[model samples]
Target chain A: MRRLILLLPLVLFLGVAVFLYRGLFMDPSELPSALIDKPFPAFSLPAVEGDRTLTQRDIIGQPALVNVWATWCVACRVEHPVLNKLAEAGVRIYGVNYKDDNASARKWLAEFHDPYQLNIEDARGSLGLDLGVYGAPETFLIDKDGIIRHKFVGVIDERVWREKLAPLYQALVDEVTP
Target chain B: MKRFAAALLLGLAALGVAHAAIDTFEFASEADRQRYRTLVEELRCPKCQNQNIADSDAPIAMDLRAQVYAKLEEGQSDAQIIDYLVSRYGDFVLYKPPVTARTLLLWYGPGALLLGGFVLLGVIVLRRRRARGEVDVGLSQDEQDRLASLLNPTPSDKKD
Candidate 1:
């Protein structure tokens, strides 16, 4: 019994250590968001083209999609097609080009099809910081009231669109139309 | 040849002293020196994830240290300096992130687990104790009576 008492803490300590090490590698996004249902952060930046700039106002009065991307980010390349589909489906996408140089971003857009309605050049990443972006290629779904309804990190595939985005889009449209 | 060698030795000695002084000498003001030391400890060496700026031999860490000293000379407080770096770089710049809702699980999870483990152990121990029933450390009533009789017998009983 005395030996068991001595061994108990050591066993618990090892178990906890293992738990922590495993937890470190666990997908952080698996943890639910506290920012859900909150209003979208207000921001403005120069558009990818033309003299007009984009702001939070553009997303207001209509349901909108905000995609935070970077020229240097590899995942952004894969996810562009999904964004294009959303655009074709009449989703208004406001692009946040995070911390990339103008020349590279322009070159990238010229090569890959630009699907954004208005692209915000966040070369300094100030707006991305405000949006709590850890890495690029994250997407946010903003409602007509300017509240951020959902935040999606990583690549958005067709499955994600069918499962997650479609239901939310349908609900919001019904809310507005009805 | 000997004279030339002596002069070369003297030159090398002077250079060594200068280098040593640059590396080791602290400022006259204790506060400045202490602040400088603390800043070096606090600053993360991005290239060397496990090491602080002072401990890292990486070139980028050296450059960051130079920048830190430059800013310190310009009269930025510790908080101001940290905030400036955090703004430029992300939270990765800080060796330790601030404890917030996002990091509460990280900060307190271990402590909670330890407390839970203790409670579990206590329950198990108490259960074992109840199962055993309290051990009678002293003699029972019948044993005590037998012991008393054995210790002090009557005179007639002793003859038998």
Candidate 2:
């Protein structure tokens, strides 16, 4: 019993150490959003340059990728080509221009080739807050019923889009299309 | 004259600090303003480095502050507002985390460790006391003398 008591701390410390070691390999940025499986938060914002507005209506009733981005976000610029490819592949992608200068955002899209079907100008980032966007270049996968399925923080490159997002998007499409 | 220069510099520095402060919003009532204050201080800014929304200058924090005010105006309770944020941002947004199965260890581990330390200390102290009581249970001087005499039984004493 005395030996067991003395070994208790070593056992507990080893357990904690194992967990910490495992955590070191995990991505700190991949924080799971609470919005997953929950209805997409309601937001209303003006179109980038159009007189029309984008609201919850644009989000619900379809499987779509809402990419929260800004002209100042380098990762968004990095992911621009992949997003363009996704657009060509018939993926419905909407851009939420979060907390950016409108003119700069427009210029970025023009220079990089616009990939978004419609850009929602969240100049004040009110919509981004509703969507729980921590920073630019966060992508949200919304299901057909307007429920947010997944959120990917950081750049959505070919690898991330293929491995992480595409399979989930495919599942949503299969369920909704049929 | 030097004192005047110092005062002017101090005033200028104070002005700069004031100018650097974030915009303060007004609420409908004192209660609303108080709630807003409490909410922002309790909510964590996800992008900032260990900063609450009230202290962080991050754009996300600004948006969260606006949302808090808007929700207050919409007649939401403080809990509802916080819950709304938690629903969107996960428990990471909360300063006071809820008691959930996942966080039970984080909340109770300290208490368990303290208790264990106390138990161990008590065991060591108790064992030390027992050891002290058992040792130098040496013979008294009278007892020692009596023992010595009995062991070396003099010739006169050996006759009996």
Candidate 3:
């Protein structure tokens, strides 16, 4: 109808408005992970401040958090307290000290309150690259079966921990040996 | 001021040392090397969003390039290598999206829209012709000849 043809521009405008509204609500920084439901990538890394090496096996046998951080990353400092709180509550937090000088990483952790069970020295970022890590302060949720359950990019805070991760963790976290 | 300049020089020197980027690969043949170039240009950089792996200097781009090189050396086919990355990084990593159930609309929607437009235009013209009880598809040969005469009468044959 002629009337329908006249109304086409309005209909298109409304459709575009709705699409732009939805776009405004989307998190531009959040990238959908492709490592979900896959086993954690294997790597052997030495301690950040010690001589012993820890492998992928060390992270399994418990539902744990693996945080990739660096001294160069300012956001890692922002999420330090949240990580410390989680660690204090008996959540075993693993660390991948990504591409930072060994002494600097050790010093930063010491000053910021070390929350990790044992930090891995990824000085060359080899393990970080294997895990598809491009930026720092990326956290991964690993189940007792050694599978990567969730990967969160950017700083993990209390709200993010509760809203995005906790419900999934409660459902997927496997039995841990005491 | 002297101290500041000295520190700046030191920092620049440190950066130069830190970022001595050396991206090298040994290909089995010229054909394989060409394929490697094509594949990198086609693969999207996850961190850089808009850049292909070949053009991006993002750390993820570097990692992807290294992975591609390693896969090539391991004698893996390009498809297998791409599949391996897709399994980890999703189809978003590929610049050329696959035609799947999810991407069916993306692949064909524009073409369908163009066809629909053509059909609609044809229908509108036909309906207008039918409504007038006459068709004006185009001017007939005789009508065209008449139009030409009317626009420019013969020079000598024109009425005085």
Question: How well does each candidate superpose onto the true structure, as a TM-score?
Answer: 0.55, 0.80, 0.79
* Docking quality tier of model 3: acceptable
Query: Which docking class does model 2 fall in?
Result: medium
Across B28-138, the per-residue lDDT of candidate 2 in tens digits comes to 789878788888888988888488888888877887888888889999999899988997789998888999999998899899989989998999999999999988878
**Residue B144 of model 1: what lDDT?**
97
Which stretches in model 1 have alpha-carbon errors above 4 Å? A1-26, A29-34, B1-160
Real A-B contacts recovered, model 1: 0.00
Kindly give the stretch of ten consecutive residues in candidate 1 chain B with the minimal lDDT sum. B18-27
Chain B structural similarity (TM-score) per candidate:
0.67, 0.73, 0.69
lDDT of 1 by residue, A21-90 (tens): 9999987443233356878767778876777777878768877778999888899999988888888888
Model 3 ranges off by over 4 Å: A1-9, A172-178, B1-23, B26-28, B134-160
Predicted model with the maximum DockQ: 2
lDDT computed for candidate 1: 0.76
**Weakest 10 consecutive residues of candidate 3 chain B by summed lDDT:** B17-26
Could you tell me the TM-score of chain B in model 3?
Answer: 0.69
Q: Could you give the fnat of all candidates in order?
A: 0.00, 0.81, 0.46
DockQ of 2: 0.57
